[model samples]
Target: MFPPLCCDSGVDQASRRRHHQSRKMAMLSFWRDGLERQLAAVTAAMDTLQRQIDRDAQSDS
Candidate 1:
């Protein structure tokens, strides 16, 4: 999911900075979680591959 593009109505630049930082954090939250899930899946796949390779090597010995 993408974060909404919002316009800041604050007259002060500091408030605008804070608002954008909050928005960026919200956007990254989804991506951070997603990457963690993907990493877990890749790790599981590697483990499975390693096990299969080990089995094959044992059979060949």
Candidate 2:
């Protein structure tokens, strides 16, 4: 009889899982940073538009 061949050992599987989780966390962190940057840009634009509107209203008065 022949012994069964396995793809990965227990240690190897655990290491791979840890590596996958780390990569996933890194990706999530990157996306979170990108979203935060976009939000900041949008907020700044809105503030600028509000200031302009206020100026225009004051001039009209």
Top lDDT model: 1
List TM-score per model, in order. Answer: 0.66, 0.77
Q: Give the TM-score of candidate 2.
A: 0.77
lDDT (tens digit, per residue) of candidate 1 on 1-61: 3433766565477776776798889889989999999999999999999999999999999
Runs in model 1 with CA error above 4 Å? Answer: 1-11
Please give, for residues 1-61, the per-residue lDDT of candidate 2 as tens digits. 2222545665577777677688889999999999999999999999999999999999999
Model 2, C-alpha of 24: deviation from truth (Å)? 0.4
How displaced is residue 10 in candidate 2, in Å?
8.2
Evaluated at residue 13, the lDDT of candidate 1 is 72
Best by TM-score: 2
